[model samples]
Target: MSSSALPKPQMRDLLANCLRFHIVGAIIVSLEVAASYEFGVAEPRKKAYADSTKTMIPHKDFEERRKPGVFQSTK
Candidate 1:
């Protein structure tokens, strides 16, 4: 029997296939995370409203009424 060498796979084809797989996987993972956040955290956080306890004030008035050194670094 004659000895024959099997064809070697091209680097470009291997790299392309790997890149395509990774891109598809990343897209799927990102979509899943976004869906989970929208359903789990985003919706719940909005409805839970730890902000409800705090009074809402006008932005300009709040800024103007701030006491000096209140926001300054203690150092």
Candidate 2:
């Protein structure tokens, strides 16, 4: 069968899935940050710098910008 025979996907569903993954990733990152903070592994200066440089994008904006069709950072 040709590729065109496959069913087309909905953008809303794709965005929802991407949002779910992003949320899960953010949770994991937050946990790591918390763990480092608790263990004192991260230096105060580094932590302060990280906190200062952290982006504060809203959830709605993040969801709007993150789409499956574009390249995204998975790190």
For every model shown, what is its TM-score relative to the native structure?
0.52, 0.41
Per residue, candidate 1 scores C-alpha lDDT tens digits across 10-72 of 867888899999999999999999999999999888876757535555665556556554546
Worst 10 residues of 1 by lDDT: 66-75
**Candidate 2 residue-wise lDDT, 1-75, digit = tens:** 676776776756888899999999999999998988876856777888788668555665566666653437721
- Best by the lDDT measure: 1
Q: Please, what's the RMSD in Å of model 2? A: 24.8
Error of 2 at 45 (Å): 14
What's model 2's TM-score?
A: 0.41
What local distance difference test score does each model get? 0.77, 0.75
Residue pairs in collision within model 2: none
Which number leads on TM-score?
1
